[model samples]
Target chain A: MPSLKTLIPAIAASVLLAGTATAGDLVSYKVVDYGIPSSLTGKAGDAAAGEKTFVNRKLGNCLACHQVTKLSAHPFHGEIGPSLDGVAERYEEPQLRLQVVNAKEINPDTIMPAFYRTEGLHRVLKNFKGKPVLTAEQVEDVVAYLKTLK
Target chain B: MKTNWNRITLIAAACAVCVGVFATSANATDWGPYQVDDRRSGYTYMTDESRAMQVDSFQNPGMIWVEQGADLWNETNGKAGKSCASCHGDATESMKGVAARYPVYDEKAKKLQNVETRINTCLEKNMQAEPYKWESKEMLSMTTFINNQSLGMPVDVKIDGAAAEWYEKGKAFYYERRGQLDMACKHCHEDNAGGIIRANTLSQGQANGFPTYRLKWQKVGSLHRRFRGCNKQVRSAPFGNGSDEYLALELYVKWRGRGLPVETPAVRN
Candidate 1:
């Protein structure tokens, strides 16, 4: 474990990154084992807004793979990933947070995109370079919404 | 009466056990999700209206481009004052089954060449004309016309000999992840081929119906154009229309759709 001296700069950098982009950036996070133990935005996300983000075609698009029976009102919930019917019951917030941030960390072969990571990506277009697919807050929002699946 | 009831119960229990065994085996197979059991063409995924549009030549918007190409074939241009008709003559006889065998290993160029490149090669060498820009009206029309000749012919691109190296490269490219989405072609086209992504149903990304008239574009477009669009969707820097990368990838994709009838100028949404 490093001292607060080493940690302070890293936290400051994340704050600076978050400040640069109003709602989008690759904010730093600490991954412990198979999960990120805290909120990426350092605050609880809005569950309502998270649900909207979850179903939004251009945003989370979690429905593109994982089916959520609660959101059956929306057309075409894909079967590529396991259904998130009782996802909240299966995993804690931390585990879900890590899964959203970068599922490749948990399962390397997973087709799921890393929603909050930008490093080591290949041939990213000019407009999306150095940008995570989902913002830190969006990641939290998705995690919050996912927690409501129970 | 009691014996008959017991027999009925035994038969019902056996049926239940059989169903249980079959269900577990089916679940264990793991066809990657959505379980696409057979190869399907992009046409199968399109709406009925789109399907109808492809079948009727008079109604098919691509037929317009095919007609345009026919006119271009006979029109003389460039210093040689030669039209495609001068050398090739009747295209119906000569160009038949030509597109199906293309993206072939060009011995002279020492690389793979698709129908588009082959067209340009003839324009430069035989006609002494400037090569039409890829995605240009002339190129799209010409390819649509040429590919139409092989409408029902199965794609049979050679992957052996010198073409073998390119094939391996293409296969690697299909599986290798790229872009901000970090998706390989296989992630959607293979693993989730029949699955829905938003409103759109993902096809196997077959090349059987290329130089196709897509409803989204509202016009005829080349295979390379579609490739660029997919790469862009994944937030990856798109390669050039006729780049070596796309050529190799195309060859690989064509191989995947081998035995599927060519549906050039086919309508798609």
Candidate 2:
């Protein structure tokens, strides 16, 4: 087994990120800039929880458009974006977080919705007007889960 | 020797065809890019269980709504003391092919009108009757009955002339990504038709079998109801029935499914 030194930080980070965005976390409404490194302040992320959010239809909804081999057990992985089978082999954690934050920044015409940023959208549904798809810590959780593919 | 060579070539060709079929089935929606829009009906993607339900009028629950619609057709209730039959005579004659040509331009209103709205138009203008609410059982029954009059007739809505602009708008809407999930109708219906989405096989989103009896809903539903459900799934606010945006969309979608045989009271999962 790997030393607790490495596993402890990741474990503690996941715990911290587990409750990062409680219902009271209204700071998600603030102006969030894309392409920022670790824009989520000091929150930690849980890969297991991130995996749940990644597959949840109401949360990330990422499976609706992207195919991920890690999630093959879950049917209907979409075909819109590149396969996320070996995503960690392609990009670093920070880069993955940036993509999750705002993929349109990399390619303006990309159909992937920004999971963290809040502004510049069209006709946001009334119930979800001010909410982002994934909270900041949730984005980190997804990034952590993705990083494990390698 | 020549005959043997010919047989070898024939076998190679058969193998190629088999491979092509396998690719489509195995990959489902994994095609490289969206180049053309496929307009096939959702019926092609249905499960055998649902198909059995759709084909049997005895098993199809939509027939219940169709029966209710027939009853409403002859009943006179408006202040004008006129039923639908009174104004139009036999539906098989007056309403024949009428449903096929709808979502047409209304020059007086300068808007696209659908079957439900057209019913409302006559109710308020000719009969002075109260209009049915969107997705109400009464409207579903009436729309299904009128659509059944066009059953087996090919869908043939106009996408040109005054409707041309709305058609373009709807085309844009189909291709344009919207909602928090940022999905376009074409992403699933056009580009990924025949692919499985969770438990449901994705169809081309054709309107041919609409006012369809959805086994999921356990009730008959209008095309707009299906549209609204899709919008909500993508985390978008659904447009109200007969609204301008949706009416234009209906025109575009109907045109997409042009020539598809009508399957009103059709069943789907």
Candidate 3:
């Protein structure tokens, strides 16, 4: 057995190595299939309605962190997150949907809430009551609009 | 009418100043959150005996956590034939001034470490004990005991040198949008501070006084638990309890409130 002094360094090193390895491949994973479903498909989500979801303080409230096109009339935009101008080009419709519905399904260590998963996480809202905040159809609509971001 | 308008404008300006002064006055109370008195001066103020009692501490649920911590401090654990006391020798003296400087950049680990992470390191190696799961009661209690030693001291997280990189990383974590709500820490704490969200008033959300007792949580919680709570408030997914991102954010927030007193068991509205 390693001495206590030596063991700590070893454990710390392994943890650091694991973190770095995961960080390098951050972008390659698929987000939607794990649990999140596409919000855009079939009847197609209305971009206008989706836009409302992006800014509605009580509902989607996306503007609280991200900066989108201000010309569209959404106010009180924040710079904490990222600019959403060209997101559509970076991800497919299904991927976009998955991120919206549940980013953690892709990254367990994420800070994104699962808008779609209704049950069985340790510290989620009881209002979700074992149901996702948004329906599969609603997710499709949001995904459709998000895909147009580029 | 022009004269009346000028008078109204003057009155409005005076009102703004008065409100500002009043807000600053509340910050001056030394007994309040973060050990900041009415002037926002960061000076910790609690008698040693008062510090020992959970009820006499800040009105938050963290008092309960501190109580639990006190118990754990004396309890024996692992193969070491020791409690934390066996090695530290009276934490009130040995551990003083320790809490204020943490989330230090470890050259060996090449990562930031807060008090809890460091304690787990001790348990795993020094004590030959199994590490407590992150956010476990055992971990929280031990951390609270250690930090209580530093009560009334100003937080002193050094942000220069290699620690600077960790600070920046923590800042990015605070600002990044990830979960469904896509909200950052600045949204609720900075931009919307003093505003009403649902029923809760958005505080400036400083982390100077943590291991705090929040009425909303009805329990003593770590800063990372609060981070998780904030993520949930925005409808975003939360990071795991002890993830590096959360630790980095904790480091940054501690640094941001650097001069503030350690309000380990502070009460929050």
Give the best candidate by DockQ.
Answer: 1
Highest lDDT model number:
1
Docking class of 3: incorrect
Q: Give the TM-score of candidate 3.
A: 0.56
DockQ of each candidate's interface versus the true one? 0.60, 0.32, 0.05
Could you tell which candidate, 2 or 3, scores higher by TM-score?
A: 2
Model 2 reaches what TM-score against the true structure?
0.79
The window of 10 residues in a row where model 1 chain B has the poorest summed lDDT is B29-38
Q: List residue ranges in candidate 1 displaced over 4 A.
A: A1-33, A72-79, B1-37
Per-residue lDDT over B1-269 for candidate 2, one digit per residue giving the tens place of the 0 to 100 score: 34798889999999999999998896575322111235456766777687778778898889888889888889896899889989888877888887778888999878888889989988888888999887898899999988888887878888888999999998888887777767789877876676655556778888877799888888989888898889887778888877778887888898888877788888888
The CAPRI classification for model 2 reads as acceptable
User: What is the TM-score of each candidate's chain B when compared with the real chain B?
Assistant: 0.88, 0.86, 0.77
TM-score of each: 0.84, 0.79, 0.56
For model 1, residues B187-241, the per-residue Cα lDDT tens digits are 9999888687766789999888889999889999999999999999888999998
What tens-digit string does per-residue lDDT give for candidate 3 at B219-249? 6678888888777865566778879888888
Candidate achieving higher TM-score, 1 or 3? 1
Q: Model 2's lDDT to the true fold?
A: 0.78
**Residue pairs in candidate 1 whose N, alpha carbon or C atoms collide under 3 angstroms:** none
RMSD of each predicted structure: 6.1, 9.0, 15.9
**Superior candidate under lDDT, 1 versus 2:** 1
| DockQ score for candidate 2 | 0.32
